[model samples]
Target: MRLIFIIVVATSLMPISAAPAQAAPLDVKGGYYHFIGDEGGDVDVTAQAAVLRNMEALTQYRSIADGSTFPGWQKEWINNLGPGVDRNFVLELNYYGAGEPTIPRPQTVDGVVVPAPDMTIQQRPGDTWKWAYGYRQVTSGQVDPLLKRALDQLKTMPYAETVNIQLGSEFDTDHEFGTTENGIAHGWAASDARALTAVQYIIGYFRSHGLPAGVTFSIGMGGWHRASFRRMHPEWLRGDVQVLQWNAYNHGTPRTPYQVFNRTRAWAIEDLPRWRTKEVVIAEWGTTANVGNQAVWIAGAGAAIKRINTDGRGFRIGTLTYYDNDPNWGELMDRDAGLEALRSVYTARPFIG
Candidate 1:
């Protein structure tokens, strides 16, 4: 049966604790938008602020990995935007070896460098190192104090009501350095053992501290790896943990927009059944092709969003935060068509009351 429910923007919905029933229809009119750039500092900041001024939520990636550099002007924008702006501010934290400080050292099993106890292969070059250290530290529930300090800083911010802390992204992808079997020789596992431990600790910390009503823990979606890994290990399927945030982009290969959309949507749908408890959010979704196809990507993504929301049975599809025009990934908003399509959705449904 098709479930036709309201798409309430997270900013608008009452706290999950208070709203036992399903959320009211989501007002997609003004959800979050991001500005991701490695450089081009102030110019990028101004442009981002202009766009987000009209949005209901805004999430910014200050640094790629765990590095300490935040956009100098981001604080200014947040401060000036004020609480009345109604935009939720989210800081993307790549705790699992993807970003900063890098993982301390590799894991050793039986005197040989072995994959960490509970992690998958690494997708990026240095990712293995990060996973190895993160797994060792996080799994033992040893990273609580550090995480608490970081979360505490974020919580004190004025507009930090809704926070999306993305733990290890694409835990299933073999491309990541630490998740691969060969990388495992260097110390990292394919099971996310350490990350999960860290996540539990984070949830408890937030709850105990009473940060806010909407603070949540989101696990990055393992899009491509879901089907591939399931085939390899049928017994590994456990329907306990919720795979929250997903990172999807429309690029690579010769696939048409429709084909890309189908492939992307399939990834989420297949994993929904395995996730019995938590909700899903397309935390990061966009197209990286040149400026021309931006509109096509947005349109295709919007259709996919509609489909997922309507038919997402066991999982509740939460937010679809689009990627912005930037260096690492091509600009998503350069094309007027793409911007218009996104704006239409954002304005059609206002996320906040």
Candidate 2:
């Protein structure tokens, strides 16, 4: 208002003259902001692409500060520029996110009576790690006990502001979860009626139990079952799944860098939106035996993350979390070689949620 008033008064006082108007300072509050840092030494594409086109400004911002890790550097960046002056800041992290909601009675979908669920996901930005509530199979009779146990554990430790209710490890599709019948875990697959019911139950439980308001839930499923199931019930898209925690891997015995890139991209970009999920994530992605040339594959993967705006709503890929736990199949990423490979990307584009 002050700037506008001054301009109006000055205009009235001065005679009409040939003078160029001064440009106003930008209000960075509402603009496109991207996070280029890591939470725990994850991949950073912004650093690897020294000459990344359309990203020089971001690159320059990062160059001025130095820190042992991303969090360290982020503090420095904020001190230098101050918050809200620019639309970029480390996302407000939540340590004790509420567990899922209670599962309600099953509802009919496509004329087939299926379990009904209720849930919601926050669509902000931050890099996250989906630690498995751990189990090869879904344990117990109802979804409440299993979910309650996990929530109890989360209550003990409060650090992460976001939690992704990932379904079955990338390899488990037997649906060995919930009330089983005669040795079969039925209906709880991602696209199945029970899976949706379970997710909604968890969300309701969280609401009733009272987890912090800032905490958020990011729930989704893995396997061809859920993705394939979406075809029969497209209306499922109108639900509260915040991020698509789908897993993608190239199982070829001797995969090359480009091959790995292509495979990863197909899942994160090419295949995810078919389900109509707005925020996407490659919850589990990596190569086994031939985790091919880490830097090369990561850069290739970054290319897909960089170009993800198909629906015209600025639908960008939010995060890429690699499967680093299973030692049975892939190269141990904990080793220096893998860490270094990861560093290249982390150094380039550090973080996202």
Mind giving the per-residue lDDT tens digits that candidate 2 earns over 195-304? Answer: 44444555567567754444444443343444543422334543544444445554556555345433433543444455444554445456564545544554455434
Q: TM-score of the candidate numbered 1? A: 0.62
Lowest lDDT sum, 10 consecutive residues, model 1, at 63-72
What TM-score does candidate 2 get on C-alpha atoms? 0.48
Give the Å error, residue 66, model 2.
40
Residue runs of model 1 more than 4 Å from their true location after superposition: 1-25, 29-37, 40-54, 62-76, 79-133, 173-175, 179-191, 227-243, 254-271, 274-279, 290-292, 312-316, 325-330, 333-337, 349-353
lDDT per prediction?
A: 0.45, 0.36
Best by TM-score: 1
Report the error of model 1 at residue 154, Å. Answer: 3.2
What are the RMSDs of all candidates, in order?
A: 8.9, 14.7
Model 2: runs farther than 4 Å from truth?
1-146, 170-172, 175-191, 223-237, 253-277, 291-295, 309-315, 325-329, 350-353
